[model samples]
Target: MSVNIPDKGRIFAKKSSFYPSSCVTEILLALLGIFVFIQLFYYLFVFSKLMRHDPPTAAYAGAPEGVSVLVCAWNELENLRELLPLLNAQEYPLFEIVVLDDRSQDGTEDFLKEHADQWRHVRFIRIDKEFPHITAKKYALTVGMKHARYPLALMTDADCRPIGTDWIASMVGQLGPDKEIVLGFSPYYKEKGLLNWFIRCETFYTAIQYLSLARAGWPYMGVGRNLMYRTRLFFEHKGFYQHKHILGGDDDLFMNQAATRTNTSINLDPESFVYSIPKTTWSDWLRQKRRHLSVGNYYQRGNKLRLGLLSGSHTGTWFVGIATLLWGLFSHDTLLLQILGAVFALRWLVQLIVLGGINSRLDRTVNWLSFIGMDIAFFIYYVGMSGLILSRKKKVLWR
Candidate 1:
């Protein structure tokens, strides 16, 4: 059978464009200019708003009675050596600590059993090797949740360290009778090189974007490093029921489906923060980030909107920079381009000035000169990997 094609003017004509090349270029440049302005304004507004209010003061200094702490690990024995002592050292009077071992080959089971007697609330679980899926971390946490005896449940990875003895109390204190989820801040441990600094900066900036959104009405996600929720909420949401098959993002993805504005709370206390060593090498960091981004497609609409706005800002910034350079090359109006460049400088200067205080508090190194290059590298990597993440249809194992 022969298929009839539509008329040229009716179909192909609409796809063809004969606008003057100069006009088309100008239109594109104008669109780029608008995008850059919007990008600058959005972050500027968020930064200014976050600065306008003081970080919330914790209402309590310790986890309430009957709080269960769950730490999940795979081949993370040495991390537990320091981690358990830290937990035992918590100022809180009442809390139970449990560690889930996901078929670890690093003798994590023996290590936990060896130190199991040191703490009053310590417990351990060793998973059998015959488990069905590669999502061991979530499965292990599920096991811990099954054994949890407290009304409140808090989760932190074995590799992470709490900032202070009051960490548990501070995190759980944010919860109230009505609150079901509490999102806490976590930053990278201070490190030695440019790579470490860049990692912390990228992580911190990404976190600020999401956590600030949580502070606003749209609460969609949280980091697992220092996440707490009610035990009832966990069962009510079915505890990663829908996302269990995905190898990563058991934390934020679960929060994406579970948290709401009325039931969620944000804990910004510095003393309550948890710090994990940032991946120091490019390859290690890349693999870790790839695992995290693999679950991005599973986020809800609000999550997508927030991330979409961020991606647009990055694209617009590059478009503006390139367009400005080209305008200087081909246009006769050199003075107008110079004026625009000055305004752009002012905008970035304001940003750096605000970031100065934030960087100081987080205790991450700040090298404005180096960040210019780091930011370019991060933007390119994130944009390139975003396509791979968005198109993924199968469950990917955690790297």
Candidate 2:
């Protein structure tokens, strides 16, 4: 009826005089640090294998059978002029280019009209009404989608430039008989300094996660810069119906509702890539990220859980690494410090390797150390802004 408790003397005896309460705390912190490093290592291993066995590029001749391309523009007339010519030069046959002018006060409508005669496939939709939601892109896309004459619809932004003449062909070619959606890679054009390098690095990292998950049969999202889906699938799934009340999540949320393992894919072929201009300013980038993070609330529970773990891993590593370093400095625990350094080095090595692979994959040049600093900044900003946005009901406006 009564359970025996361990003798206090025995318990006390097991505790080493050298292992003070502070030492115990330090030891626990060190173990936590090790755990984070190990988990990250595991992710790297899995991610590496996914990269190794990525699906080969699909080869479909001519234009995508029954497909239409949509580009949405606000005040990007000059960019659109460059982008339109590139679109016109695509090798794809039997496709049309439709641009939705989101009530641009700039000469965007005039530019489209001038070019409409020059390019037969070119068409324009002028959205005169005020954008209904913070997700202005989605509203414009919806209007464009209605005008599409084909069953398959592809969406890209005005700032994106196709990598090759076969860009459209490669993307459309990936649509298997049963597949309803295909996510394509959107890399960035090179830039001059650390910010640009960091942007590319961050973009590459995002690509790795999305591409790996797509390979793993859990395709959750795609960038609007180079994304394709069946026109019917959009309407069938109610077309961002539930998440429309929110300001973000046109891509991921729609993909969340519409994509299944059998119906989704990633087109990683070099020819299928599209390059977009990176945000030039840190404030601009932060706003973009804030809009993106606002939609995290709408992800499927499984995805939410995965993302939570990923965030925790980064947060855990930073806290544990700093705490352990302080412990080593204050307590002079050389062994503990060595363990922490070893873990940090290993994590950095894995990240560097993974990042190198990403860089090579995207043809980017990154200052690895500078990228680490940027990553930390991003982590802090994302956590803080995301927490604020998710808790508040204010609609996110694109700056």
Candidate 3:
């Protein structure tokens, strides 16, 4: 007597019931499929809507508000030399430039002192020392915030250069009675090398996510490179008093606590954007990424969970999808093979549409030939960041 043999899929399905790990993998894939599909919807619909929104240069009509551009320099005399002149040239009628020379052993203080007389609107404060226990940036920024004469504080880095003369006006133009925080896009300058290209794409992708989330009415974080907030809000929230111990998060943590759907606005106008110099070496880039990732643990619980789900799903989609495809190939499971291939193709096509438009709007360059490799690289980046954030032995010192 012989038993009847089922088809390949039916045979695999029958065995999957008996194999506990296989059954668990199937269940996990099913749930992850649902999650990743939802995430794709967010990317396609919600973030695409943001891409379609008018650029702030054209849409925003608010009168020029009093704005202060805050830049903190730490051993960045060369950068400040190039950066200060650009700030002095901004066409905005009412604004001031305040620089916090955060204990720089370099000639930042002397450079500022030499040029301080020429730019009447520019002010510099020398911070040679701070409370040894506290992070220097928080202390330095607090001092600069106090020195700002304008009600609106626009913050950027010494290494960042404004693209256009209207950068200040474009940023502060979004401020009204209701909107107190302005999230501006900052992109890394495009360079010939692969590292710079990846950095540019990463920066643009990050900006798109944060700006889209803000547009979705779930504002979470902002990049300090081109972020603006009300001066009063800083004082109301006690000015980073809670997270002063952390080296980073001055911009993002403040936004996480203070920014609201009604109060926050995003501006991706080309003129509003700034160019940040990307790290040239692999080690430096990783160090910069580590510092940024370090503050993520301090984010609001809801935002943290939401962002975690997004990243987790991205990693799972690649990892488990590849594994399933491999298994299906060997097991002769044609349906599973087709399903995984179709999902990846569909998601990539949608991403091209959504991210393509965003890249165009933000003036970022992406190498389509290496998109998959970059995606995998980003997964590695996220993993490394996780290890760095979790390790107590490893510390991210403030720059």
How close is each model in CA RMSD to the real structure? 8.2, 5.0, 3.9
The lDDT of model 3 is 0.82
Candidate 1 per-residue lDDT, tens place, 66-184, comes to 77899988888899988998987887767889888878899898887787997887888888754565377778888889899887888888889998899888877787767888887
Highest TM-score, which number? 3
lDDT of 1 at 192: 89
Q: Report the number of the highest-lDDT candidate.
A: 3
Q: lDDT per residue, candidate 2, 47-87, as tens digits?
A: 67544655546676544486789998889888888988888
TM-scores, all models, native as reference: 0.86, 0.87, 0.90
Better of 2 and 3 by lDDT: 3
lDDT of 3 by residue, 129-170 (tens): 879556888888899888889889999999999998999888
Tell me the spans in candidate 2 whose CA falls farther than 4 Å from its real position.
Answer: 1-17, 21-34, 61-64, 131-135, 365-399
Deviation (Å) of 333 in candidate 1: 3.2
| Candidate ordering by lDDT (highest first) | 3, 2, 1
